[model samples]
Target: MAKISAFEDLEVWKEAVRIGVEIYRLADLSPLKHDYKSRDQIIGAAISISNNIAEGFEYNNNKVFIKYLHYAKGSAGEVRSQLAILVAAGRVNNEDYEKLKSDLSGLSSKIKSFINYLKAFNQKKK
Candidate 1:
């Protein structure tokens, strides 16, 4: 298989961006009008996931990149938690909530695994 050139080329990052788009769409349907707080928070967290990944990849330093990966994972968790709140408050249906939750979980795991892989790779080079 050919080598991947950047994190933008990574399937995980692509999936994370898709998840972000879905979150934005969901936020638009939320009944909490005049509450820009939660909506912006959720959208920001979702965007952070892919943004961090792209920023990390551009850094080219394993340690810095891993830090950004961790940030992305945290942002995923934030988005997941916010979605859970929306579900509990009856703002989002079970179907949408579950689907987004699962996607976020997968993105979190992928980011963590990528971080571990990079750490190991760098260690081997030292």
Candidate 2:
């Protein structure tokens, strides 16, 4: 495999960006748009997933990258939890809710796998 020099090259980062955009669009079209607190919180968490991944990768250390990946994974869970709240509050439709939730779930898994990979690599280096 080729070396990953930029965070943009990461599939998990791409997925996070897609989910972030979807959440933004969802908030714009759904009743969530009218809900300032929920809208902002959901958007923040969605955006954080990608941001953390990029931030960690920039550190250029496997340990640091792993830490950041965990942060990204946590943010994905936050987005999923907020999504559930939005759906329960009737702010988001069932279809969009399901799709975004599934996306976040997959993203979280990917981030976890990446973290494990980094941890193993780091261990081998020691």
Candidate 3:
């Protein structure tokens, strides 16, 4: 297995980057773009997802890392909620909202799995 030396090398973090970019592009193309408040809030939540992961990993402690992972997962939920709001407002189409929602949910599941794995690893080290 390849060793991870930085947050950028993390698969979850990488996936978040891809999703963030996609959300930004779609948001820009949608009517939501004109609503700076919603657009910025959604984008900020997207960024927070991966950012929490990176920040937690830097602390180099499994317990602290797990806490940050929860934060990241929470952010994913926030983004999904924002997406739903946009869809309801007709600022974003159902198709785009569904796709992004799936992506965020998948990411949240991965974060949960990662947290579980980390907890197991920590137990082993104890």
Candidate 4:
């Protein structure tokens, strides 16, 4: 495995970035464009997922990184929740919403796995 020296090199972070871009694209479509509140909130949550991962990795501490990973994971969940709201509000189509929701859910799972790995490694070092 390649050494992960930066957050951008992380698969989880990359997935988060993709999820964020997709959220923006979805927000640009139809009624979401007019719903400024939901648009901003969803977009912010999506971006936060990747941002937290990157910020935490830069901290150079596994514990701190894990904390940030949790934040990112929470943001992913938040985006998924927002997607459901947007779909129910008729702001997003079923197909688009399902795709984004799946992606966010997958990202959250990846983050959780990474956190588990870090926690295990930290425990081993103790």
Candidate 5:
């Protein structure tokens, strides 16, 4: 594998950024556009996913990176929950909801897998 010298080189961080962009686009649509609180919250959570990953990577320590990874994972979950709420309120359609959920789920899994990899790497170094 190529050495990842920046957070942007990480697949997980890329996915998080994609999700954030998609969420922002969705929020710009009709119903979601009017829902200020939910829109802000969902946007914040989506952004947090990428931000946490970047922040953690910048720390340059396995333990600190893992701690930020956990935060990123949690933010992914928060985005899913907020998306569900939007779906329930008719702010988002079923198809969009399903796609978003699937995307977030995949992102969450990627984060978890990376975390596990980091843990194993740390253990091996000990």
Candidate 6:
């Protein structure tokens, strides 16, 4: 197995980065113009997911890292909710909305699992 040294090595972080890129592209294609609140919100949430992961990893403290991971997971949920709103508002197509929603859900699960794994490891160290 490959040794993982940073959050960048995390599969969840990588998926979040991908989701952020897709959100940016979707926002650019949105027909609601610049005044669309959902555009910025979606992008912000998507970016937050990956940003928190990186920030938490840099902290080097398990507790701080886990807190940030929770933030990231929350961000993923935010993104998922925003996507649902966009779909309901007819701002995004069903296919695109579903894709983003599924990806966000997966990211959320991965972050939660990783957090649990970290907690377990920390417990063993105590």
Show pairs that collide, candidate 2. none
Q: Candidate 3 — which pairs collide?
A: none
Runs off by more than 4 Å, candidate 2: none
- lDDT per residue as tens, model 4, 11-120: 99889888888888888988899999999999999999999999999999999999999999999888888889889989999999888888887788888989999999
Candidate No. with top TM-score: 5
lDDT of 2 at 104: 91
Q: 1 or 5, which is superior by TM-score?
A: 5
Off by over 4 Å in 1: 32-34
lDDT at residue 101 of model 1 (Cα atoms): 90
Off-target runs (Cα >4 Å) in candidate 3 are none
- The model with the greater TM-score, 3 or 6, is 3
Candidate models: Cα lDDT each: 0.86, 0.91, 0.91, 0.90, 0.95, 0.87
TM-score of each: 0.91, 0.96, 0.95, 0.96, 0.98, 0.93
Question: Candidate 5's residue-wise lDDT over 18-40, tens digit each?
Answer: 99999999999989999899899
Give the winner by lDDT: 5
Worst 10 residues of 4 by lDDT: 1-10
User: Residue by residue across 10-106, what tens digits does model 1's lDDT show?
Assistant: 8878998999899778887857434588888888889999999899888878899899999999999999898899789877788999999988888
Tens digit per residue, CA lDDT, model 2, 9-125? 999999999999999999897578989999999999899999999999999988888888999999999999988988998999999989998889988988888888877877888
Q: Looking at model 5, which ten-residue stretch has the lowest summed lDDT?
A: 1-10
Name the weakest run of 10 consecutive residues (lDDT summed) in model 6: 30-39
Candidate 4 colliding pairs: none
Better of 3 and 4 by TM-score: 4
